[model samples]
Target: MKKFILDLIVKENEHINEDYFVLKLTSNDKLPHMLPGQFVEIKVENSPTTFLRRPISVNFYDKELNELWLLIQIVGNGTRKLSEVQVGDTLNLILPLGNTFSIPGDKNSRLLLVGGGVGFAPMLFLGAYLNDLGYRCDFLLGGRSEANMVQLNEFKRYGEVYTTTEDGSMGEKGYVTQHSLLQKKQFDMIYTCGPTPMMQAVASYAHKRNIACEVSLENMMACGFGTCLCCVTDTVDGNLCVCTEGPVFNITKLKWQI
Candidate 1:
């Protein structure tokens, strides 16, 4: 595992209600080559409750700026403290961990990218990566309210963006699955990350259509690397480490029940 002392070059609160912050870290050395689904373990220096680092998905990267972006929702003490990080401060990170989303092999591959709440992190990068691989992509975002949605512009560069909020204040009033189904279109593959139920719903829809789907699970984890074995999950294959074996897994390989 490569360790880096990076500068917290930029920090901003993107969404007010949810306390979602977009942090940019710049490394003095070459930034690790990261993939869509990989995450970084960050230590929120000097916190009582948050002793161990928290794992957050890599949201975006700009090679020219030598910067990496993170979409962090301030849930507890760790994130609350992370929100306070200012420009030029230092943060320790172990990055490029966990497996990443697979690249489509064909140019005409039609792809659907779905995300819910802060779970939208990886899917943003996934959409861009898939587009770079010559696949046509469409993004569907779901949130409790418009305030909970973030990084919307990032996905627009990849493909069409469709949104749904629990309340009627946003694009579509309902869930993301509803918006996706409304399109009434079939895709060659599906990729998603979000709350358990949201991902499950998308998986069900894909399965019923006999389309391939992959899910990036958001499990509570520590040692974001594989050594801790804290991110163990039961799958059709066997017990697997979400940190190592996957934060990304094919829906068919998961043991989800009806």
Candidate 2:
């Protein structure tokens, strides 16, 4: 658990009347290399109710610039206060703190990445890596509306991008699972993150087709590590900490009730 005082070098509200924000942080100290599915625990400088540092995924990183980017959505007081931070502000952070997705092998591997809402953060980095390795990838993103689909443009370079919106305000009108690729294509592997129902849906789809699938789960985390025992889940392998054991897990091992 390496700690650092990172200066909020830039902050941008990516949407209107929405909670999504892109935060860029810089530190004089050399930070650890962050993996795609890993996250960071950030301490909101002066809030009491938001006492514990919030764990947020590492959206992207720039080694040359020595910076880290986080795609945050304000869903509560902690994140709401986090959004209020301005440039030059500083926050305590412990980053690169969780397990990551496994890169797929084979040139013809049909890789499918599915995300919803702010859960798209990890996929951006995952997509970039797959693209760098000469792998073929397809991204399916779903949101309530176009405004909820953040960074869809940024991911175009990494793969063939597809979108779905409940209101038909974007690429296609329906849930991402309803996208043609999910319904028609046979992927060698599928990686997903989002709401539980959505993840469960993707997992079920992959399971039916016998495709290898992994999901990065988003749960309410306290310690952002294994010690807290806050983010626990029952799996085929028994109970595991979502914070440390996962954030990433094989879909086949997930003991889903639904």
Candidate 3:
């Protein structure tokens, strides 16, 4: 897919919590097609300490409104600057970067999406996409606390929403891998994005169950293109750039010990 550099107007900047915000952006031109698991690189203007653009996952896209949603976690100067932008501010972005999650051919395939922390960003878009195609999607999301879980209602609009929190402040008190939903039901495919450790656990569980699984890696990225080679990961095929080759890969291809 071709990439574009555009100044997207901030339709809204929603503060989900102290650590996270959702930026809804629109363009004078129609928004480019974006796929689940893809991301955007946003230029941080006026931030002297931040030189590189931050890579953010596509949270959700409202085609009817021509809006692109970005779920951002303010972890550094670049993101902090991004969070400060007001409604109607223009954010320059290179978007629809990286490979997307695979869509199962069988519409009847049962699917589960697992997400943790800020990694929950991409799952929403993936679920919505799958739902639109008549696939049933069940979501298992985790956070340190209830406060970390955002967009619960929005997720429910797509499928069954389940949650876990380390502090027991939400649906269940445990990691997503430990959620009882896994034991209660069997799925044909599983897709996950989150911390490496958490994803590894999910992959191991799926592997043992003979279920197909794919994980979206959150390796540190810069340039949002493959040129920087900063987000390369070892795979069965060889080292590959997460930016260009994938942010998403099947568990079987990954060199993870599981």
Question: What TM-score fits each model?
Answer: 0.93, 0.93, 0.98
Report the C-alpha lDDT of model 3 over 80-160, residue by residue, as the tens digit.
999999998999999889999998899999999999999999999999999888999999999999888988998999999
Candidate with more favorable, higher TM-score: 1 or 2 = 1
Q: What's model 3's overall lDDT?
A: 0.93
Model 1, range 1-258, lDDT digits (tens) per residue? 454434444534344454688887776777877888989888888788888888999888767777788998888999999888777777888877889887677788878899998889888878877777677898989999888788788889999898999996788899888884546887888999999999999999889888889999978887877888888888988889999889999998899973
lDDT of 1: 0.83
- Give every collision pair in model 1: none
lDDT tens readout by residue for model 2, 36-109: 89888888866678878898988887777878888998888888888888777777787778898988658789
Candidate 2 vs candidate 3: which has greater TM-score?
A: 3
Candidate lDDT scores, in order, read 0.83, 0.83, 0.93
Displacement of residue 25 (Cα, Å) in model 2 is 1.2
Tell me, what's the RMSD of every candidate?
Answer: 2.0, 2.1, 0.7
> Model 3: clashing residue pairs?
none
**Which stretches of model 2 miss by more than 4 angstroms?**
1-17
lDDT of 1 at 46: 78
Q: Which ten residues in a row have the lowest lDDT in candidate 2?
A: 7-16
